[model samples]
Target: MQRLVLLMLFLFCFGSLHAQQTEPKKYLVYLSDKNNTPYTIQQPAQFLSEKAIARRQRQQISVTTRDLPVNPAYVQTIKGTGVEVWYTSRWFNAVVVRGTAEQLAQVNALSFVKNSRSLNRISSPSATNGTLAVKNSSGTSSEALNTMLAPGDYGLAYHQANMLGATELHDAGFHGEGMTIAVLDAGFPGVNTIPAFAHLYQNNQVIGTFDFVTRTENVYGANAHGTSVLSTMAAYLPGKMIGTAYKANYLLLRTEDAPTEHNIEEVNWLIAAEYADSAGADVINSSLGYTVFDAPSVSYSYEQMDGNTTIVARAADFAAATGILVVTSAGNDGNKTWKYISSPADADSVLTVGAVDSLGVVASFSSRGPTADGRIKPDVVALGANAYVLNSAGNLVKSNGTSFSGPIMAGFATTLWQANLSKTNYEIIQLIHRLGSKASAPDNTLGYGIPNYSRIVTGLPTLGAEEGVALVNPVTGNDLIILLADNWRIQLTELQIIDATGKLILKKMLQPDQERQTIDLQALALQKGVYLCRFISGNQIATIRFVKL
Candidate 1:
């Protein structure tokens, strides 16, 4: 009798479970048109902030229909089906809702409903406990004695900052003041409580915080990746550490979910980006990238890295179109099998950053790229390997990834932009590319290489006097030959080659009208490393860097 009762109980539970499984799942309903919208492009002030409007006015970008909100009547009709509307996307003219099959059938019957797709459901890894682990150190402790360094003292981070000429910008009083940056990343665990960020809080530089993953205002919980990333740009601990844009205002946004990887996170990012745009953010620094996902079926192949295909990439471009500069990481996938940059980084207008060491050499793990459309990726690079960052505990730590590099570059870019308010975003991006170390010879490894802010700000040296110059057979066992442009018989006053440390190793005083010159580096017994060749023709000077095998 007892065994029979147990069997009957199991049967009843199974029946109930099966019945519940038959219920409808949530779907993302894409709308066809926004014909019934109450808002209009002429009244952009309703949706866009004053700063946002000013940006558009300064850039001469006009408001369009896309800037208007989605049709409210269409949304109300969908909600009438007894389904709870979760979120709405103005960019896609869509809404996400949870409803039963019968309710969804009613929604599909509406003339405005274009199509609906089921939202992907995936289980979170137990190790993560539905939260991404904080990689940086975090906690409260007594302030160390060395916490009060001079304002100009960058401590261990000096090399990274100096590499991009950030120190020079800071010295020029362009420390990103009057500019606002939106940092979009996984999480920022202890930003409000950490002493390293005490200045940011004290000065009220942290203008706002939002968690898109949980749809809440509390972004101070999920993980510390953002905290570390932010430190690269905003940390102001004297003597101990200093960020690139220590004086800049910031908006902290949690867009990436550390515990789970899904297509939804991309949507979350898009939402956060729109928020940043509406909030009048001048620049956005996103260290997040997407290629693979927890659900293998939804993963993006290498070929799909084209700038226009991915949703996030399209959104990034849209963000740029709004007169906001978007800076993103190039991904740390160089040493892996899928050794190409991730989406959004592939977006043509976005400033994608790669990683390099203190010596200005490309990091082995920095993602390489020649976009699907054949454009050189990683518009620029910065010090990312063993990059200095502050943990939540208000302690300095060394971390490695393109994640840190992107913000470092972004911070510098902010200062640069602050210095030149008249320049458009497109013009600024082009200037940065032209100012990179390898701007003229960019490749897949380190596109355009590192940038020098001081050089860009002071005006790049003019090369008008000469047509072209090249180091024939750059890497070889024989003598290296310097080739000048055809019909260019300019007098060569002096030629010098220096080592990586700026030590002059070879010097030659050339005769007048010697257009072509040869330097036998083997006779100098130079070491195998990178060197810069400096050529002087009357008042014009040009420098070219080459590596020795």
Candidate 2:
């Protein structure tokens, strides 16, 4: 997992002209408060070179900051010292300072300063321009399909299980048990009471929620997109349809203020994402897209769709660099003349998601992209046509958009991460691309076809001190026992027995340290036959074939 960080926008790009004078040196100075308590002081002026100020002014950069002390009087001394002040947060009790080689040495020589570094921002492409809008759900419900449908029934599910690399993660036991996802979107409607969400509530998975739109904690607004997205990851069912991640936690953030279009909503999203980060979210699933604004003059041009031009795009990229998986919808504009992805989706690091119809064809409404920088996008796809969701009136409904597809992919990403705790965001992404391209080839429509969880299951490196498969002998009539191993080294945290054809027969939670555990096979409504026993420990995982005598 990447370390999660979210950077808010200031819209100032500082430019400095290097002087030909003796090349300046940079240094990191640790300023000790001398006392353990938090402290604040004006930034020394001797640190900012004269050239830096001209650039700051040109960039409209302001010195006043709540996160850092910015007294002009104190800045003068640091002038020409080739030093620069980057980020300062009182909570961290530290201010990042930068200066040319010599200037850095001078700043470090001063007292009361803490630490300094050669400040470098991670480079990312510009964000897309477009808005992520969720349509109203039609009051309807699909008959409980978990019992009747196989994972292959939904193109998205099949992609994850057999195509992408999702089945492997599920087998590794990273069904997102302890991870937290902050879903920033429209309203959740009746998520709290929906049968699809019952497991989340019963398992205490719904840790916290808020509505930035209404300034309230409850987010059951009339929109059903949020409900559908949530269900893709958190819905729990045994022997029926289980989400890609059956046990992940969620934080619903209602940031969309429908009926009103204002720049403030973007700010609201920023604040909401900050709140999510503070809450220790492992992933941020935002199906919302942004592009044209209510004000035509403010609307973004194709060139401006460069990820760096948009405030939200910058923040989204920063969020990914920080380690949180920031997933967003590519937008439903394929049929339009623009036919391009929306903002933030243009963001380079973001996992821009598109939608695929039932037959694996790209949904006509799913956004198209060859980002401004020429990066292929809509990194993945999932079912979005006539998707299932919950309405405000506590009923299931159907809706369609790249919106539904984003969450479905997010659910798979979370589960994948849960399975391979050691895998970096880049590696996870590469694996996704690897699986898809290996099966077929990459294209703008689907960067990596869909993820396959099974490859990861059989391919992840081995773990623990023990090795080899364990044989379990039946003790009595209709007896069943699971011979477990710390295959992932984290432990054999969970086990699920299913028929070879993919019908789930039983589910069990096993202690990581325990090697042998007995499960009541007959109690699980299973018939005498061969079964696949899935084991999840950590990133390492494996499945064994067994016969239920």
TM-score of 2: 0.59
TM-score of each: 0.75, 0.59
- Candidate 1 wrong stretches, greater than 4 Å: 1-26, 99-105, 122-152, 457-549
How far residue 46's Cα lies from its native spot in candidate 1, in Å, is: 0.8
Q: Give candidate 1's TM-score.
A: 0.75
Question: Candidate 2's residue-wise lDDT over 331-424, tens digit each?
Answer: 9998898889988899988888888766667889888887888888878777777665445554445678888778877888887665444455
Clash pairs, model 1 backbone: 138-392, 138-393, 139-393
lDDT of 1: 0.77
Which ten-residue region of model 2 has the weakest summed lDDT?
A: 132-141
- Cα deviation at 423, candidate 1, in Å, is 1.2
Candidate 1, residue 472: Cα displacement in angstroms equals: 40
Local distance difference test scores for all models: 0.77, 0.59
* RMSD to truth, every model: 12.3, 15.7
Window of ten residues with lowest summed lDDT in model 1? 131-140
